[model samples]
Target: MQFRLVKIAETSKKKQTFIFLAAILLALFTTGLFIMFLGHDPVKVYLSLVNGAFGSRYRIEQTLIKAIPLIITSLGIAIAFRMKFWNIGAEGQITMGAFCASYLALNYSYLPRPVLLSLMLLGGFIGGSIWGIIPAFFKAKWGTNETIVTLMMNYVALKWIIYLQYGPWKDPAALGFPKIPNFAENAILPKFLGLHIGWVIALFLVISVHIFMNYSKKGFEIAVIGESVNTARYAGIEIFKTIVLAMFLSGGICGLVGMIQASGVNLTLSKDITGGVGYTAIITAWLGALKPHWIVLVSILFAALVQGSSYIQTAFGISAASAQLLEAIILFFVLGSDFFAKYRLVIDWKGLSRKKENKL
Candidate 1:
């Protein structure tokens, strides 16, 4: 029995190593094909992509700026995903958070700058959590499908943002533009060492989340619930409480992205305030195996892909459409490779069978 257990453990470790290696090779090869398809020398394109992302301080800073929001949103997604919850509505939740933050900032611009900014951040957090909890409530009480509800909520959030920007919040100074007025200067999040405040905060949050997910009793319960809901129930874990709490935390974090973009970068709310960070974050969290630290790495890699492709367009006189196409191609290869990495196919080589089966 001891030997069997040891063999099983060894086999598991071997499979993990093989999958990691395979994913890397597959991503590279598939990206190579994309370069060839674009009629550019794969080597040149690849080098340019590398240089665009990490060849200098300016590039690295930009990459970090992009990574900050991605990491935050992905962290939220990782939580939901680990619990087998499908929250396609992060986009909407983010939008709501931004809208709420913007609202508070605009109204309380008279307050001291630091206090005003604090309120805005709190507004964003509460807004996001509220949006997230809506589905969680229904799911806990009625057993509704969260996936469908979340997806629909995204549309609702989009339209709601549109309604406000166009109808009530429209920047009158912009002459009919569909956006809110710029946030009060005092309400803005301060930049730190030329890096976004969001970056600093996100870094802290990532570490916190890592510790939370891997160490805490609540995290253990979440894991238990994820592995087997029935088993968790039998073990006395409260399913309804876990579901609501997890989803609320997930959505709340996602919403903060909206607040970051609105106050830190855009300084105004728009229909696209979330900048599609919601969807991209899903990819980031999944690619990183739902771990906080790895999610940061994956988010950085994705940032590089976008940053490099944009530069490729600018330098080579390539059209924006083509640059985007190549970016999509590379991402597809990278993401799809992960799927195969975790799974394997066994072939019927030599038509072999076990002795017991052959005898039968």
Candidate 2:
């Protein structure tokens, strides 16, 4: 007998939902077994994780703080991915954006606080847009591989920021400590009722992206391009223009996250400012299936994992590797379940019959 996999014609929404829930439950169950093997109560560990992430108003705010950058960066990633553009350079764009915003905050301290903040936003956006444009321009003109170019750009941007932090942009008054000068009061993002305004911006962007992708002409063009380049060309969609524009918007949004991270949280620029958000947000974008609102939910779930991981280390006395293990296990199950939902196993009757006849 031979076995093979076949694609399903269609999957019902209910089945997809069930599959998603099953994946989550299976991940939890497997993780629980691992915890049990460690001589710890899995239920207690999970409850502790929930409490640590959302047991209080303060915890919720912290989770939201983490989610804000993920949300913005994921939205940016979703835009490029929607058009079949693999923009893996969000990290570089983020670093460059923060650097631009910090320049204004550090040297242009005389400007009004509100004005400084506005200019910082613009600077960050432009900086990120430029980084995105570099690879995209080459890809459009020369048919170069965007994935490699974008990935290489990430290292370049990262090194540039490190040099600035340790070199020309380093603060001289810190008594030899390698750090940049802090932003002036006006450069910082204001908090509203204990949370930074970045949340507000994130919320607005969520709605805007949904509308743009679902209702706008440009969005439809992007969708077509994603489906097939040949079809897009035949439809006269101006492939070059669409690619460049989409990448610019995508990188620009990622750059805004840099500004938010600097202004709202760190209030300074450093080599570690991005904290791997660019990469993490890509997961959020994919798990959310490139949907703006869906990305919000995925971001919250991921933020919880992050905020809770520290507590797991403290309470369980397990290494940080445990948290990573749990994350990997969960991702594996989720993707595996999705694959089953899209395909089914079938017996190869022709091969099975031949084998039976041979045996006879």
- Local distance difference test values of all predictions, in order: 0.81, 0.89
Which ranges of candidate 1 are over 4 A from the true structure?
A: 1-18, 317-360
TM-score list, all predictions: 0.88, 0.95
Clashes of each: 0, 0
Native-to-model Cα distance after best TM-score fit, residue 139 in candidate 2, in Å: 1.8
Backbone collision tally, model 1:
0
Q: Give the C-alpha miss distance for residue 179 in model 2, angstroms.
A: 0.5
Model 2 regions lying over 4 Å from their true place: 348-354
lDDT score at residue 270, model 1, on the 0-100 scale: 90
Over 26-110, each residue of candidate 1 has an lDDT whose tens digit, in order, gives 6666767766876778778778888998889999888788888889999998888888888878898899899889988888889
> In model 2, which residue pairs have backbone atoms overlapping below 3 Å?
none
**Which residue pairs come into collision in candidate 1?**
none
What tens-digit string does per-residue lDDT give for candidate 2 at 1-360? 799999999999999989988997999999999889999999999999888889899889998999999999999999999988899999998988898899888888799988998999999898888888888898888889989898898899989988988999888999889898888888999998799999998999999999999999999999999999999999999999988998898999999998989888999999998988898888889878899988999899888888877778898886766766776787788888999789999988899899889999
Backbone clash total, candidate 2: 0
